[model samples]
Target: MAGTSEMIDLKSTPHSLVENFNLMKGLLATYGPDELQVLREKAFRNFTEFGIPTTKDEEFKYLSLRALEDGRFAPAYGATIDRFELEQSVLGPIDAINVVFINGEYAPELSSAHALPKGVFIGSLKDGFTVYEEVILEHLGKIANLTGKLGSTNDERFVYLNTAYLTDGAFVYLPKGVSLEQPIHLIYLSKADHGPLVSYPRTLIVLGENSDAKLLESYLGMDGVYFTNAVTEVVMGESAILEHTKFQQEKLESVHIAATSIHQSEDSIYTNNNINFGGHIARNDVNVWLDGEHTETWLNGASVGLGHQAIDNHTRIDHAKPNCNSFEVYKAILGDHALGVFNGKIFVYEDAQKTDAKQTNKAILLSPTATINTKPQLEIFADDVKCTHGATIGQLREDSMFYLQSRGIPKDEARGLLVYAFAAEVLEKVTIASAREVLENALFAKLKESQDMPEKGGE
Candidate 1:
């Protein structure tokens, strides 16, 4: 454990950040060999140079990190929680294999990975390095390299932080021509009773050529004011098909920042469903690189914020090769004084002829104080590419409420029904039936809570 020095000025440099850096250096011996040590040093330097992003940064212009910085959270290295307590906080059902992590450390007893397929490997990153050393070394930091041009200054800093503090997370590898019958569920739980803490969880998924698999990553906080900085890197081999889903439901007082990067090969299919329901301040970045021809990608996301919560969703899809296709839809529902932000970008390189990309972001404000900022952008250098992006921000339609009310539905029920319908458009796109059911029920409950409050502009 690391302690912050009170004599240090917090204004010039965040004391907590500095303390965590020192803690990481001290724990470097536990990470791995000299090779990983060098990589860690490089990542630390990147974090120091980029620093924390401020309001002036273009990518984070709509959101601020002051709340997180002021918290001065140190890294949670030796934190521990009971297995029963951790199991109770899991998001999905207990049927799937659950790779559980508590306070950034892998808990094998809480995890169930004994029955995986013959060739499929699902385990912790720290263990993966020892068992699949060659593979892990080859692809561990490759995505970070590819993301050099994808993130803002703040994003880069977080990426570096994640790399420097990278300890334990889920790692899955599917061999060529194999299909996983059951989805691999990765569950991350944060429990920080001692003090304000932070945890960095990393995940790596690789699908071999012609392989098929599904993955679910869920983040939950049992209690306390903490921060969870997580990063997931996925590589899809030629003709690989993968369905990925993420659900984030941290404690309301916690700050959650996550980044997911995907690299698609030729003829590969990648689908992602990201759902955020908790956290005082939550930000998610999803980036996909279509590095091969004939790649197909689908992205669907939904965020629900209440009280003083702030949720931001950012996504980017790069059609680097020709004949690639992508579709994205993100929706947000905010109530009380909550704020929501959505930014989606599509980039089609000059060589990506016949590329087709489409993005849509819709936001609903349930209260007068609730705010939303959405930006959808498309940059296409290829003349033959079909790229389109659009954003919509509005309140629940009174007409729709009236129409539903005319059907004998109560006013509150009508509003809840309409809100649920709006959010279901993206939730229904989630292919995992179990995960979708949980999310649908959660959204309905959130909508009902929002409906209990008086209309923002009405009596």
Candidate 2:
């Protein structure tokens, strides 16, 4: 172990995680070959070096891992879930190829049985390495690794943890010039049927040149006290386009941590829409490196927090090449004693003269006790660039509420409609019709659950 816990006290470290990591190593290492085992060992060094991050760590300042440190959560490598239940639970209002994973392990029997495109490949990472070993080797760690450009202090802290304990996850690959008419839905079901559990979900997606695809991923907690630490890596070839949407609908007792790393090639376009509605403690981080010129990126997110839950969104867009354009918009709705945090940073390199980046973060608190902390930042070394960042935090406008109530709407209806409209701005960004429908339902459903919201702070 190279980097041990130097920040937090060793006595207060995440003992359970250390134990689980050691236990899973011997068993899970057999899934992959020796090459991967060597890589896993290398990652373990980074994990021990950084240790589990504490609230004191700037990267994890807003969210605390005290709960995880206090309790012992065994790793879930295999779990049995009902097939019909998976369909009724996660496949709501979507007709697409469904890839189901239970407790981080791929469930092939439950996945879509239809035939895929001639040149496309979709299966478990476990199977991908067997069938497409060359592609897996070339791009897996290239986009996201413990010792590489992608391995920043913020990434090393948790990403290495996932790598050290990783088992099996989804793997998707699309060949050049192939566009699937239907989308791919990845459903992750975390079922702690036995006791408290922790699952680490890993994914790697590679899109070849001039290809296009739409992807949907959802994290669901069937029912139990559990934690999910998930990581996704994307490799986009020149002129490739991908539309990705993520839905976080875990149980309130579940904690969810998600991180995504993307590498864009020239003329590539990547758009992501994140909708967070559940999880007792949910934090999502998305980092995009526009390494190629003429690349366009759009990052949008909407989060709804109620009760004593907490939601945090952190994103970074690195403009490494010139002539790149990136747009980011994030919105949040908090009620009761919940908390929301957003930190978005955009960095432009010296040679990235034609970089045009814009970021906007807005939040609405529906209760006097609800709290929101937001920071939008930009760092530019190029003088001939257009970069702007702004954040707004406030409650519902009285004038707008009055306008709605004076017409035909009641107070509760008016308030709900206002909140709905506020969130719809980002929800409308979902391009897939079925996925948008699912998000719309979750948007209004979460807002309704936040009813009886203690009056908006000032009145």
Candidate 3:
């Protein structure tokens, strides 16, 4: 970490900002002139409102950005990456097209396209700006309206900062009538240089009409006090079908804050599975907007919290038209003195007379030191809507554990087996078979790691 003087000087005049703006300004000067101006205005506003987050803010009650105030971090400049580094920083055995982003910049040289299905276009958002500017312009900031959301207060600062200083990330666009069997994977790796640095990864996905595809996105941060502020937006066109999975496994020394927005059109089907496993402070905000009638959406997630880390999942499902349906299930396994928070909100608009929504949040405390806070809510403006929301936090089922033990398994192994079964209900729902195996292995390993951890209450 830098000293007080060094921190002050760095924050006051960040080299990353200077380098990024110059590059972006030059890029925008060539294309997106109008959008560039708008981004500048947004950045100025964000800067005015952002300094550091305190405990009083409800959205940030469990997250503190004070560690970021030291100001030794900057948006990464240049690719400056090695293939070995990419392989070491990521979770492997991946048999799909891999797009790598080092400190938020796309690294095609390090990425591979050998597994991509024919006709699938995967490239950098910056490069796409030159070739697919219209699509990028049409969808950029469409979900993240910097005017009213939770992060909007500092929109000028963070939004503008990201927009003006942004360099690269994955851009996935499935042309109309295209169907991809293999998943397109995007990996965001944050390299901390043994100090306080941040990586802002921006991802955009567009599925055209009658298109079908699956996406696997993951985030992993190396040592040092790293921060991952990522924003992902997905749009599904009418009659399109998409299955998206996101896995976040940053290290314990990292702070991760991510926002995912999904928009579904008429007769479209969208499924999102998010599994969060790491990070000292991990918070994910997911918003689903059902704008078309006869649309179907599912939001499922499982999180594991250990040590003193806090993981929060805030989800919102909005039914804007009639005959839309949504189901949300989030499960958490808490260990040590960790904390898990789940807030699920379902909104049925007046016109959504036949909207159907169900939400459930469940948690299992492995140790007395673990804590879980869950709030499930439903707001129905339409009297004909059918909605249900519930939350449950408890230990493993003793009867199930006893059954396993009676079958000759040891006590601890039996307990673990039952716990795995409890969490498996949601895990089994993961669409990709290969990804499912990887997730299962990771979850079991995490459970084993926390099993030996000292329980605060010693159950």
Q: Residue-wise lDDT of candidate 1 within 145-199, one digit each (tens)?
A: 5444533322556777788776677888888998887877888888888888999
lDDT of 1: 0.80
Flag clash pairs in model 3.
43-160, 45-156, 46-156, 46-157, 47-156, 47-157
For candidate 3, write residues 74-102 as lDDT tens digits: 55544465777655543655667788887
TM-score of each: 0.92, 0.94, 0.87
Top candidate when judged by TM-score against the true structure: 2
- lDDT (Cα atoms) of all candidates against the true structure: 0.80, 0.82, 0.74
Alpha-carbon RMSD of each model? 4.5, 3.3, 5.3
After TM-score superposition, the amount by which residue 53's alpha carbon in candidate 2 deviates from its true location, in angstroms, is: 1.2
Tens-digit lDDT track of model 2 for 407-456: 97778777778888898889888888888888887777677687554222
Clashing pairs in 1: none
Model 2: what TM-score?
Answer: 0.94
Task: Report the poorest 10 consecutive residues by lDDT, candidate 1.
Answer: 1-10
